[model samples]
Target chain A: MSPSERHNVTVHGPADGQPMMFAHGFGCDQAMWRFVWPAFSDEYRVVLFDHVGYGGSDAAAFDRHRHATLDGYAADVLAICDELALDDVVFVGHSVSAMIGVLAAAARPERFARLVLVGPSPRYLDDEGYVGGFSEEDIADLLESLESNYLGWSSTMAPVIMGNPERPELARELTNSFCRTDPEIAAAFARATFLADNRQDLERVRTPALVLQASDDAIAPRPVGEFVHDRLPDSRLVLLSATGHCPNLSAPEETVAAIKTYLAR
Target chain B: MTIPAALLDESAEDLFETAPCGYLTTAVDGRFLRVNRTFEEMAGREREDLLGKRRFQDLLTVGGRIYHETHLAPLLRMQGSVREIAVDLVRPDGSRLPALVNSVLRYDEAGRPAVIRTTVFDATDRRRYEQELLHARRREQEVALELQRSLLAGALTEGEGLELGVAYHPADKGLEVGGDWYDAFWLVPEETIAVVVGDVVGRGLAAAATMGQLRSALRALASTGFEPGALLEALSEFSRRHELGQMATVAYAEIDVRLGLMRYACAGHPPPVVVEPAKPARLASDGRSPPLDAYSFWTDRPDASLQLPPGGMVVFYSDGLIERSDRPLQAGLDELLASVDELRDARPDTVASSLAQAAAGTTGSPDDVCVLALRRRPART
Candidate 1:
C-alpha cells in the first residue's frame, strides 16, 4: 500500500523531506493528483495512491461495505503509514477522502501533524441552524442520478457540479473512471457518506487544518468552506480563485503555492 | 435453403437499421426537438420532415397523447425531471411505439427553459427483464410472508374455558423472519384449554416450517389428557424425531376454568407473569425445563400448577420478549412489567403495541417476540 508501488508518485526535489500524502477524489485514481504533486514533492516525501478499488490497485479488495464510507479509506491511509513506517505525517485528502483524513486525524490524533483538507465536506445537506448548502430533496435527486445510469450521470454531472464547461472531456473522463469503480460499492459508500451527520466529528478535530477551496467549485461552495474553517479551532481558510472542483487540475501553480505556504505556516 | 453470405450481411444491416431504440430531444415546452436518424427512419419520415413542426405530445399515439398532456407533461413541468417514465409514442402512420423514456430540465444561460434531452431506452427487452426481476422478488416475499401468516397464532377449540390473546412480531431488520408461535386451543370433553408459546431458533422459511410442525404437534398432543409435564416431554421427543436443526423455548399450560387450576410445563421458557391487586405482581409458576434440542442433555422436571383464582390476567411470553444486550433478562422482564403497569387495563391489542414499544426502548433493533395474555373471568353463583 506504499504510495510508490501502485500510484504515480513523481518527486520534484527530495524524497526524504517531510512526508505529505495526496488523496484523489472520486472517479479518479492517483492521476487526478498528478499536476499538483510535482510542485509539492520537491519539499516533501510526497505520497500518492489509488484508492482500494480504482486505478492499478487490486479491484478484488474493493467491496460494498469496505469502501462505503470514509473509515475504510482512513484505514487505508493508516495502512500506508504502517507500510511506509512514516511518522508525524501531514495528510492531504481531496474530495471524499479529504473529510476522511479529518476523521482519521480525529480518531487517532497522534498519527497526523496537520490536516490540509482540500474541498472537504463534513456534511453535504443543510439543516436548521446549520448550512451545508444542499436540501434534502436536492440530495435525494443527486442520489437518484447516481443510481440511474451512474457513469453517464457522473460524467455529465461532474461538469455541472464543477461549473467548468471548458473541461467537459475532463469531467466526462473523470466521471467515467469514477463510475467504473464498483457501483454497488459506490452506492453503499454514497449512503454511508451522503446520509452521514459528521458535524460532531468536525468539532473534535484538534490538528492545525487548512481548507483549500476552488472559487467557483460547484461541489464545494464558499460558504461551506467558511463553515469548515469556522468550526476548526486551529485553522485558516484559503480560497483559490479557480473555477473548478479540482483546482489542482484547473489551476495547479496557485494551488501548489497555497499548499506550500500553508505547510510552511 | 442456401442463403448467400451477401444476403446474410444485408439482413444484419436491416436488423441494425430497424433497431428498437429511437433517440430524440425536445424543447422544454414539450415541442418536437431533434430525433436521431434511426428515430426518423422508424417514423417513416425524413429528419427535416419531423423537425420543428411537431410537438412531442403530437407524436404520441392517441392514448399516449392524452397521457402526456395529463400526467407526464404536468409532472415534468413541476418536477424538472422524470426517469424511467413509461409511455407510448405515436408514429406518423398512426402506429404506436411502446417505450420507456427519461427526461431532464435543460436550461438556457438565462436559466430559462432551453431543451429537454431525453434518452429513451427501448423497453421491449428491458421491460421483460425488469418485470421478471420484480416478479421474482415478489414471489420470494410472498412465500416468506405466507409462512409468517400461517405459523401458530392462537388455537381455540369449542367449549374451552380459557381466554388467550397473542402477539408475534418478527424482527423488522429485514434479514430473515424468526419463528415465534403460540396456540391456545382446547382439550375436548374436560372443557380445558391448552396455551403454548415458543420460539424456534434461526429464521426465514426453515424456522417458519419448523414452527408449523411444532405447533401442529402441540395441538394434537394437547388431547392426550396427560399432565403439562408429560405433554412437553412428548413434544420434545417429537422435535427430536423430526431432526429439526434449531432449539426452541416453550411454555405449555392447561387451564380448567371450573377448577381454577393451571398445569404448566416449561421448556427453558420464560415464566408466566400474573398481574394481581395484592402485592407488586409476580410470575405465577417458576418451574424450569431444558430447551428442546439434541444437545440440551438435561433431565425432565416436574410440571407446576397454580390457581388462576378469579379476576387475574396470566401473562406468558417468549424469551425474545425478555432478551437484552447489556441488561439482565430479569431487568428486561421488570421493564416489561413496569411498561405494562403504565398502560393499565389496556386492551389486548393496545397491550401488544405498548409491549412492542417497550421492547424497542431496550435496543435499537427489534427481536422476535410472542406474548400470550389469558385473563381468568370471575365465576358465577
Candidate 2:
C-alpha cells in the first residue's frame, strides 16, 4: 500500500511552511493531537496520521513481521517522509512514539530538523539502576486491561481519557475515532509499546530535541524523562505542571508552549 | 387531591442524599467538584476527602484508568454524553466495585465546557455473565481446531519413481478451522497412486466434519479400482444417500508410474495444472462437472487422460488457491500458472510449498488453501 493510504496522512497549515509531523502514542490514534496540532497549524505545515491498524489507516496493510518491533514503526515514519518529499521536518511524538522519532531521526538525519518528545520514556520497565515506574508484572496487567476493554469499550472511556468532561463532543469524537481500531491490532501495539527498550537508540539521534515531561505522569515518571534527557546528546527537558500521561489532552497550553519554545530555539 | 404538608415539605438535601444511583459532578478536567451522599456511600469514601482531593478516574483500577484516558474521556469530550460503560472502581479498602457509569458534559453560557454530571450503577452480575460468554467462545474455537488437526493427520505414500507433496493453510482471520483438505495415498503398491484435494462449503466444525467424510469416502471408492470420473460419481451418490458433503468441490487424479499415464476429473473445482519438460505449464481444463449434489440425478461423470512423459507433474488444488477478493479468478489462475512455470523443474515439495506461499503473499489469506502436487519420474531400469 502507498504510504498515504497505509498511514492515513493528513496535511494542514500552509504549503510553504516548515513541515511539523505529529505521531501519537499508544492507546490512541492521531486524534490525540487534536488540541496540540492546531496551535502549530498557523505557522507550520502540520501533518497528522494514524498508524496502520489504528484510526482510518488501512488495517489490511498491517503485517505482523513488519510491525513486530519499534523498527517497523520507524520504517513507517521514514516512508511517510519519503512519500511527502519532506525535508528538515519538525517531528513531535507522544509517549512511545518518542522512541519511534528517535529511531527515525537516527536512520535518516537529513529528513528531520528538530524533535519534540511529549511524556517520553526510553524504557517503561524498571532497570537495575534506573527508575522506570512500572514492573514487568505491571506491564502484563496493562496488556490484560487492553484485552479486556477492547475497542468495543473505547467509546465509553475515551472521554475520561481526553479529560474534557465539559466538552463531551470532543470525547465522543475521540471515542469514535480511536474505537475503530481492531482489538487484535491494539493488543499488538500495547505489547510493542510497553515491552520496548530504546535507550541505545537515544544516543544516535543527532537532531536537536526537546523532552516535555509531565510533572506527575503515572506512565512515564519524572526520573524516566530525566533519564531520557541525560542520554540524549543535544536535548533539553521542560517539566510541565500537568499530572498525567497525556498532557496534550489535559494541559494543551503547557504542551504547546514547550514545543513552541523548542522550535524557536 | 390535597397532599400532606409534611410529605410535600421533604428537603431537597434529603432527596439528593437518598437517590437510587450514585451521582457526582466534576470539572472539565475530572477534578471532583461535588459528590452526592449516594456517590460517597457507593464509592466508600467520605465526601470531605473526595470533594477537592480526588478525580473520578483516581477511584478506578490501573486498567480502568488507562481506559478512562484513552476511550472514556475522548468519547465524553466528543459526544457530550456516554452511557453504560463498565469500570472497576477501587474502594478505600482496595477491593473492587464493578460499576456501570454514564456521564454528560455541561457547557457554560459562552459555549465552553464547564462541568460534568455522572451516574454510577452496580454491574457485578452483568460483568460476570460477559466473562462467562467470552470463555465459552474461546473454548469452542479450541475444540474446532483440535477436531481439524486430528482429521488431517496422516502419512502420504512414498515409493521409487514417484513424488508427491501437499500443503494446507487455514484462514488467518477467524478462530474456526476451515474445510479444505488434501490426501495422497497408494492405490496399487509400487504401481498406481491417487491424489485428491477438496473444499467443503461453509466453515467451523460442520464444514470440517463434512470434509473428513468426503475424503474418506473418496479413498474407499478409489480403492475399488474405480476410474477418476466413476469414483466422483459414486462419491456424489454417497453424499446424497448420507446427506453429507453438499456443494463440495473436489479434484481427483490417479497417476500410473509404470506407463506414465494420468487420469483426472474435476467437480466444479479449478482444473489441475500440468507441467511438461521445456513447455509452459497449462491448466488441464477437461472432464468438468458441477459441484457435488448440484444435480438431482447422478450421471456417469466423464474422465480425461493425459500422456505424462518422464518428469511430468500434475497439480491439484482447492478454489482458495486461485480465489482472491481483490482480483478476478482468471487473473489468479494466470498468476498460479506463471508461478508453476517458474518452478516447473523444481521438486514437487518445493513447487507445492512455493505456490502456497505465493498465493498467501506477505499477509496470510482469509480462507483455507490446499494444494497437492504429484510427479511421474523416469522408470528405474
Candidate 3:
C-alpha cells in the first residue's frame, strides 16, 4: 500500500498553503487534534492521519519489526511529507509523537521548518541524576493496565461499534476516539513509547522547536519537559496552565494559542 | 403488594450516602471533591483524610494510574463518559480492590470540564472469570502449536545422489494455529522420496487436527506404493468418508533419484516449480484438479512426469507462497519463479530457506506458508 493509504492521510485547507501536520499521541488517533487543527486550517494546509493500526489506516500494514521503535513512526512522517511534496512543514506532535517529530526533523532537516511538541518526554524512565518519572516496575504495571483495558475494549466495543451499518453515529464518534487496535500492536507501541531513551536525538535536531508542557501532567512532568528543552539547541519551553497530559483535548484554546504564538514568531 | 409511601420516603442525601455501589465526585483533574459514606467505607479511609486530599488516580496501582492518564482520561474527555473501565484501587491498608469504574465529565457554563462524578463497582468475580477465559485461550494456542510442531518433526530421507529441505511458517497475527503442513519421507529404501505440502480449510485446533489426519492418511496411502495420482485419489476418498479436510488442497510428488524422474500431482494447488541447470526456473502447470471433497463423486486424478537433468531441483509449496492480498496471483508466481531462479546455484537447504524468506518478506503474512524442495545430485562417474 502507498504510504498515504497506510497512514490514512487526510488533507484540508488551501492547496497552495504552507503545510501544518499534526501527529496524535499514543492512546488515540489524529482526532486528538480535532479542536486544535481547525484553528489553523484557514491559514495553513492542515494534514492529519492515523498511525497504522490506530484508526482507518490499514491494519494489515502493521509489521512488528518495522514499528518496533520511534524511528519507524518517523519514517511514516517522512513518507507522508514525500508523498505530498511538502516543504518547510510545521509539525505538531503530541506525547510520544513529539519525539517522532524530532527524529523526522533530524533525519531530513530541510523538510521541516518548525516543530511543536506537546507534553513530550525524551526518557520516561528515571536515570541516575535525571527525573523522567516512573520506573521499570511502573512501566510493567502500565503494560498490564493496557492489556486489561484492551481486553475490555475489544470485548465490549469492537464487535458492536466497528463496521456496524446500523450504528453509524457510534462508529463516527469512535472513528478516532479510543478506536480498537490489535492488542499486540498496542502493547508494542506502549513499550516503544515508554521505554525509549531518545535524549541524544534531541541534540541533533536543528529545526527551531516549541515545547508545550502542561503544568501538572502526570505522564510528562514539568522537569521532563525542561530536560527536553535544555537539550535542543534552538527550542523554547512554554508551560501551559492546563493540568493534564492532553491539553489539546482538555484545554484546546490554550493549546491553540501557544501554537499560534510560536508560529507567529 | 406495593410498599407504603411512608416506608419509601428516603431522602436523596440518605440514598447518596448509603448506596450499594461506592460513589464519589472529583475535580476535572481527578482531585477528590466529595466522597459518600459508601465510598469512604470502600476505600477504608476517613472522609476527612480522603476529601480534598486525594485524587481519584492516587488510589489506584501504578499501572492503573497510567491507564487513567492514557486511556480513561482521554476517553472521558472525548466522549464525556467512560464505562466499565477496569482498575485496581489500592486501599489505605495496602490491600487492593478490583473494581470496574464509570465516570462522567460535567462541564460548567463556560463549556469547560469542571467536575467528574464516578461510580465504582466490585468486580472480583468478573475479573477472575475474564482471566480464566484468557488463560484458556492461551493454552489452546500452545497445544495447537505443539501439535503442529510434533506432526512436522522428523528428518527427511537423505542419501547419495539426493538432498531434501523444508520450511514452514505460521501466520503471526492471532492465537489460532493455521492449517499449513509439509512432510518428506523415504518411500523406497534409497531410490525414491515422497514429498507433500497441503493446506486445510480452517484455523485453530480443528484445522490443526484435520491437517494431522490428512498428513497421516497421505503417509499411509503412499506407503502402499500408490502412484502420485492414485495416492491423492485415495486421500480425497478418506477426507470425504471421514468428513475431514473438506476443500483441502495438496500437492504430492515422488522423486526417483536413480532414474532422474519426477512424477507429481496437484489437487487445487499451485503447480510445482522446476529449476534445471543452466536454465530459468519455471512452474509446471499440468496435472491439476479440484480440491479434495470439492465434488460429491471423484474422477481419476491425473499425474504428470518430468525428466530432471543432473543438478535439477523441484519445489512443492502451499498456495501462500504464491498468493498475497496485495498482489495478483500471477505477479506472486512470477516473483517466486524469479526468487527460485536466483538461488539455482545455492544448496538445497539454502534455496528452501531463501524461497520461504522471500515469500514471507519482512511483514508477517496473513496465512501460513510451507515450502519443500528436493534436488537430484548429478550421477557420479
Candidate whose TM-score is highest: 3
Write model 2 residue lDDT over A117-184, tens digit each, in one string.
Answer: 98888888778887776677766766655655654435466335333423535534543455545666
What's the ranking of the predictions by TM-score, best on top?
3, 2, 1
Question: Which candidate number has the best lDDT?
Answer: 3
Per-prediction TM-score, please?
0.46, 0.87, 0.95
Candidate 3 per-residue lDDT over residues B218-303, each given as its tens digit: 98999997778878889999999999999999999888888888898999888889999998999988888889988989758999
Q: What is the DockQ of each candidate?
A: 0.02, 0.29, 0.57
Model 2 CAPRI quality: acceptable
True contacts kept of each: 0.00, 0.20, 0.61
lDDT of 2 by residue, B7-61 (tens): 6776987777777888889997688998888888889999899988988998988
lDDT of 2 at B1: 93
For residues A1-265, write the lDDT of model 1, one tens digit per residue.
2434333233344667878888776545666666778876657888777776454454434433445667877777777776777677888888677788888888888878888888877777777887765566655544433333333334355335234423434443442333234444445655665566666778889899889987755456788788888888889899898644566654667888888898887
lDDT per model vs. reference: 0.66, 0.81, 0.86
The Cα error of candidate 1 at residue B325, in Å, is 1.5
Ranking by DockQ: 3, 2, 1
Candidate closer to the true structure by TM-score (higher is better), 1 or 2: 2
Scored against the true structure, residue B62 in model 3 reaches a CA lDDT of 81
